[model samples]
Target: MKLELLASFFLLTTCFTAFSQEKQDTAVADKGLIKVSVMYPYAEGKTFNMEYYVTKHMPMVAAFLGANLVKYTIEKGLASGIPNQPLPFMAIGTFYVKSLSDYQAAIAPHGDAIRADFQNYTNIIPIILVSEVVN
Candidate 1:
């Protein structure tokens, strides 16, 4: 009986330790910097042109900013609850940066280039939001 109890206790402790370690790993994985660019297009254009910008201009901007572009997703607003008319297409660009200052410095040189590129594309100014990953 004593041996069985000891074995159960050891197993329980091992399982608990494993669970704790997994939680810590998850926490660490969730801690990172994310920069999001919410891209909106001008109302008077065809979706084809917006798609072209996403395919062509996005890559150039990402490269110029020196950010690791993780993913780019296109989403449409259904029930977003925002005041403005729902954007036809919203391009979300996710980038990971080491720190806020690092992110700012990396994209600082590309400001003029970004503006120039935007002028060539659409008049709709994109909203950029930078956030730190917090779980």
Candidate 2:
């Protein structure tokens, strides 16, 4: 019947619309990107505390700084070609921020607090980088 065919058409259109909207929302969420690499040189016997800092303290600081934690990764290898030399641990934390200035301002006030909390873990040198989402 024509009525049944019309009903089917409407249902199909509605489903497609919902799917399209969901895709758009996901794309928006994926648009913002911020990356920070924290280089750490740990003292001997402080390796365990370094793990604790990454797991527990870093998240707290990231939250306090208003950063949405996207992902965290670690890579270990020789700092140079020397086999016996201990390479520094790199903690790479990715986040999503609205803008560069917004990200800067968010952490400006907490500089001292952040340093105090993280000083026990290791000597940290934070490198901040930003990128655009291209898909």
Candidate 3:
């Protein structure tokens, strides 16, 4: 009887340990790794040439930012919550980077030239964010 009790207790502890690990994995999956993002929001009556952005600007970004840039995504804001109203933003650009320091180190060297090309695309100053992905 004592041996059986010991065996059952061991099994119960093992099950709880496995359950704890599964819960931890789920939490991690719910909240992803840390990352950096650079977002460009639009303004009213702003002159933004999407053609130039896609052709000339993005290529320059990829070339200048270098390999530390994990990835990049481009979004065009369609409509806001209010019905029959224009969206607050026209376009938002996101860049997935390793960290703030990594981005600064990689792109600082080319900052001058990279910034200089801004006028060729849009007039609005971009909103940059260095943050983690928690979704």
Using lDDT, give the best candidate's number: 3
Overall lDDT per candidate, in order of appearance: 0.63, 0.62, 0.72
What is candidate 2's lDDT per residue for 1-135, written digit by digit as tens? 999999999999999999999999867776655545555543455443547676776776667555445544554433645676665544444555555576678778888887787666555555555676543
Query: Distance (Å) between predicted and true CA of 88, model 2?
Result: 5.1
Q: Clashing pairs in model 2?
A: none
Query: Can you give the TM-score per candidate against the true fold?
Result: 0.55, 0.49, 0.66
- Supply the global lDDT for candidate 1: 0.63
Q: Sorted by lDDT, highest first, which candidate order results?
A: 3, 1, 2
The count of residue-pair clashes in candidate 2 stands at 0
On TM-score, the stronger of 1 and 3 is 3
lDDT of candidate 1 over 21-105, digit per residue (tens): 9999966865774646564643555332456566777777667556444444454434335666655544444555556676577
Candidate 2 residue-wise lDDT at 10: 100
